[model samples]
Target: MKKSVFLACLVCFVSVLQAQNFPILGKVVDSTSGQALSKASVFCQNTTFGTITNNEGLFYMNLPNGGYDLVISYTGYEKKLLRISNTQPQKDTLLFVLAPQDNSMAEVAVVASNEVADGWNKYGKFFSDNFIGTTPNAAHCTILNPEALRFFYTKKRNRLRVTAKEDITIINNALGYSIRYQLDSFSYDYNTKISQFTGYPLFEEMDTTEDVKKTWVSNRAKTYLGSRLHFMRSMYDSIITDEGFTVEKMNDDPKSTKGSNIENLYDSSFYFVDSSGVSVGWDGRYRIGYRKVLPDKKFLQEFRLPANASVQVTLLDIADGFVIEQNGYFYEQYDVINSGYWAWKKLAELLPYNYEYE
Candidate 1:
């Protein structure tokens, strides 16, 4: 028994000695400004253990000795990743230079319905060439209601797993006229069930001149509200869709009672090509417009836009199409904006390229 106990103790001591551990400490900062990246999320790919950088962009964690793929994410910046294979308790400084998301297809081959042309290899090349673009100005923005920008940024990988239903409302207030709106409804699987619904005043009780002046929040909210509104209104006015995703000029839903008298005032469509002959994707090129309602129903919330305001995805040369649907709702400004608009939300699904619809 004495020999057995000694053997067990010896084994335990050896095991402890063989175990490996290290302390990983680092500071994350903006490459350009050298400013600390606060609340940045740091994690290992395919693992649940994670930590967030402090306000000073500093993080310290004890990790097992092994190779790790580390991901760093923050609001208004492109995600950064690094492969670390060190086991020394050491301090390291990492600088992250974030680029904006580009929203253009640099090259695309268009084939008619009858021709089964050779599969093209333009998708990857186009995405690569077009990956370079300037980020949107951090100084400008349009307001979003129920703003969850920070929450989305601080989460894991910026890959959001929304619940059964989700709502996104964008409002445009240009030239002091509250016009242009887009509402999206989502299913549990996270497909956009509806893409765009325009012309409906997202709310009633327009902010009075007094309210606009008195009910002021942060400058971020003000800029977002103003910039988003301006961008949408400009797109609606300049759209010339002779060739692109067939944009509907008017709401066909008989159930829609929004701005019924405003002839051709509300339109929704997919914009295909810019003047430069570049094929744009629905993710960014498509412009959604909304209309103004009474003062009582505004749904504008405040949040920060990504400094790099663009996101571009390149697809395989498959004929992937998106489904678009729209619906109308009665004006209930407070509940709609505060709790999220139900009827006005939209969703979309990717259909096979060969699929056709009447």
Candidate 2:
């Protein structure tokens, strides 16, 4: 907790497809009891495609051809993450066994009086700023159940840890969706200025009129541009420059001295790129700078940052190669470290993985 621990969870999985369909079937059961777990949430992480298990613990989903980070969660049980691939034909049903949380390991006693209340009052804004984001769209996002969150602050380590006692409901007016998120782990290290969270989210679209639907369509497209999904697609296609992005390598050595000259560090002279001139897979850290200036009046009014800002992102090593679907839906191990302008854009600006530009 004292170290620079950043667990940023900003991506949602949902993809809109035209025709290709891959059906996925799975079941959830208790690991120790071997009993079927009904009402357990099953979802493809980062996408709006998900469902709850039936009484028989069975669930099914039809997804477009691609890879997926499949997640399953149930109350009082450990969350399960599975890599799924619909790119190839599958003949077997998938199964997941969730273990009950070990009470001893999961318990955290609050020593201070009204610590939960005080911690929320003190760090709720910080959690919201980092979790929901500070973008114009984030303004439309409202967490429906803040009480489900329990916060613990360790002053000695300057770290704040958050855990969800229940699924947190969030309504996103900007994207026209309501999400139920099962947060497994969350931590913010003030010393390192990094925040991270892991959860499984199930999204339900709001019912709306044709006019509102059209508006959402346009809005989703706007949010998708220059997003993490778009950036990964550009990298896969080797069109970074065409997409108005520049890449630079940074000295991320933990032993390196911290420098004070921010502007000098961002100078174009230090720009870097892979000599192969192609993205082989999801592995590397780079400073990504976007040149496109957001023209949204609302964004301009709410956020204050220079027109150009850079974000640091690391594509964690994956056993299998990263997958980018035909529609720019990305499936891989990665995290975005927002800085400058991008840091201000939060949940309000989020689009589901299945979102498509018409």
Candidate 3:
């Protein structure tokens, strides 16, 4: 089967499965404005079976008779994840209210900022500068990240290795597929911190010759890493900074003089667009990009920021406050972007208000 044809079949198969049996129905609205979010993606994690919100921000999906993760995600707002294990014969009606990201603690219950106006501006500036054009830490390995993320999605696999850094190659025996995300080279602009990434189409050579093979891979890639890439770009374009960034430093330092070699994924020597600043101390400001893997709900991994940068972190939970049942069902897991999930590790060392700036 051809790659393109395979992917299409894969999409249809997942869609059919999601639509089987009974379906859940609901609308998504902005918590702040009470407005509907149209074209929003409402789907089950690990499966392509899902629907997009209409003009009214309404969506529906059919699920098997088991526990499943219902994820609602849209741009410019936080993502929502809900677990539904429904035995009800009637359609389950669900509603979601997405809150605007709190730019400063003064704007929310966490009163860290003394001047709401100034702090909000600082927040806005941070986003506007860093997120205006491209995204941060995004130019490298668009292909391999998908498989690593898929391990989390399918929950069927455990270990994942990117056999080739130049290409994202994965061996998934359970899925009956071997996937490859080949890339052109990686380049970056140190000033902007925007990594320009280019890639070849996703390919899957499977034991079975099915038409949906490619589409399945494509859909999965887009659903996971592709969406992340898009979000990363959005964040970079929206980030604002006082220092602003430019591609000033360029190096292929195989050593990756920085703390981690992950940064080496991109051509260190090439100049790319940038926006965020290097946080010099507990006083510096930044708009950080962060995402937590679910199930474990622990801070498993993170994209690093300048070390010792005074930072503020926000936890976007499955409802506003759906307490994670693990960890003694703590109200929520509080992880910092710069600090990974260890924000509470040394909370006493940072300021109380949750604001980095004085």
Which candidate should be chosen as best, given lDDT against the real structure?
2
Ranking by lDDT: 2, 3, 1
Q: Pick the candidate with the highest TM-score.
A: 2
Native-to-model Cα distance after best TM-score fit, residue 30 in candidate 2, in Å: 2.2
Better of 2 and 3 by lDDT: 2
Residue-by-residue lDDT tens digits, candidate 1, 17-72: 55654556778887777788788867653233367899988887665544455667
| Candidate 1 ranges with C-alpha deviation above 4 Å | 1-19, 87-358
Per-model C-alpha RMSD: 24.1, 12.0, 22.2
My TM-score estimates for the predictions, one after another, are: 0.26, 0.74, 0.30
lDDT, candidate 2, 23-68, per-residue tens: 8888899999899999998898667898899999999998875557
Candidate-wise lDDT, in order: 0.33, 0.67, 0.38
**Native-structure RMSD, model 1:** 24.1
Number of colliding residue pairs in each model: 35, 21, 43
| TM-score head-to-head 2 vs 3, winner | 2
Is candidate 1 or 2 superior in lDDT? Answer: 2
- Tell me which of candidates 1 and 3 scores higher on lDDT: 3
lDDT assessment of candidate 1: 0.33
